[model samples]
Target: MATYSSNDFRPGLKIMFEGEPYAIESSEFVKPGKGQAFARVKMRRLLTGSRVEKTFKSTDSAEGADVVDTNLNYLYNDGEFYHFMHPESFEQFPVEEKTVSDAAKWLQDNAECIVTLWNGRPIAVQPPNFIEAEVVETDPGLKGDTAGTGGKPAKLSTGAVVKVPLFVQEGEVVKVDTRSGEYVSRVK
Candidate 1:
């Protein structure tokens, strides 16, 4: 364990406090007009998915826990584990459905991204920032209506739906903002 001053704290830095693991969310150094500077920190509890805020003297030190992250390629899912292979070493690992959550459903086969590990086990996955998936289905455009004010629903190959311009049609490959589940632009 390493002691890190509040000044050393940064987002995604993992620390152990009271036998639980937490990662820093945000930290701000506040200088009160009459008092010493302190660090206001927000942290996310890894086990419970809860957030906590606390203030510490700027020089206060805490035990820093070790966490690891690696860039990898999503190979495929086995219905149980979403498998990933490291880009450099080709070492592979899998995280289960619950851990990947809705992100797994958003991933296409062989996608490249990052995965975080704690104590040599997968804890979270960072999927690709964006993806281009073909629209599999949607209501047909109104016949000759020419009124484009309203948008139609488009379903992507990942089974996620987005409101697209009236002109988007089935089989069109559209760039998707995976984080927001929104269509960005038509690929072609």
Candidate 2:
């Protein structure tokens, strides 16, 4: 574990507070010109999926946790668990549905993901930055629906529903921004 001052903070830095791990989601250094400078941060709790805001003195330090992440490829789902294998060691892992529930809807066989491990056990899962999935159902495009403001909803191959332009039809592959869960563009 290491200590880091709030002044040196950056997004995605994992720090420990009160024995819990929190990733810095957003940080802002504010000096009101009268009082001491402080760093106001919004953090996401790693294990509990809770978000919190904390204010820290610019000179105060927080403990950095021992978190490790490894890139792994999704193998298959056995109904109850999702399997992943490391590319280097070929070791396989099974993550419970409770852990990867949200990602399962966007998951497809052989997708690559980053598994966050805390003390060698998977604590959090990160899906790909972007993925290509085929749309399964949606209303037909209107003849004059070119504004693209209020797009139609469509179910994707991975079971996630996203808004796409009316021109996007069923059975067409489209790119999705995994982080934002927004449809990017048609694949082909």
Candidate 3:
């Protein structure tokens, strides 16, 4: 296995700590005037999605984790697991609900997603940054409400609700930012 030193700490770097894989969310080097310099790291556990902070001395090093991110197509969910397949290879992987996390809200059949694997097992799933989904339910747009000023909550076909512009009507396909769950624009 490879190893990473404190100097190499950076966001998205995967390392093994306490026998578990953690992806570094942020790393800051602190050099005080009193004693030694250390790196403060904020990382998220691969399996649990929990965040933790750790301090490492300048010379400290940690083993590199066997983490890989692959492009996969979203399949159907079987209640217990969400299935995904490689576009070319057609190899399928079943991921747990906890591993899919918040990305489940944006997932649709045949949607492209990034699946993070740790040691050949699915650890996390990430939907595309932007998705176009049809609005399934929302309050009726009032007459002459084309100013796009106020907003109303609209439920999408994928079971995610987001605030849409006043002019947005139900059954319209709208582009959404999955990361922030914000409405982007009405699709043509």
CA RMSD of all predictions: 2.6, 2.0, 1.8
The lowest-lDDT stretch of 10 consecutive residues in candidate 1 is 142-151
Task: Please tell me which predicted candidate would have the highest lDDT against the true structure.
Answer: 3
After aligning candidate 2 to the native by TM-score, how far in Å is the CA of 155 from where it should be? 0.4
Q: 1-188 in candidate 1: lDDT tens per residue?
A: 88889988889788886676788999988898997889899998765567999888987888886667788888888888889998889899988777777677578888887777878787777778899999899888877856655688888888788888878889999997888877789997
For each candidate in the order shown, give its overall lDDT on alpha carbons: 0.82, 0.89, 0.95
Off by over 4 Å in 3: 143-149
Give the TM-score (vs. native) of candidate 3.
0.95
User: lDDT per residue, candidate 3, 64-139, as tens digits?
Assistant: 9988999999999999999999999999999999899899999999999999998899999999999999999999
User: Taking the candidates one at a time, how many backbone clashes does each contain?
Assistant: 0, 0, 0
As a TM-score, model 1 comes out at 0.84
Q: How many backbone collisions does model 3 have?
A: 0
* Candidate 2, superposed: residue stretches over 4 Å from native: 142-150
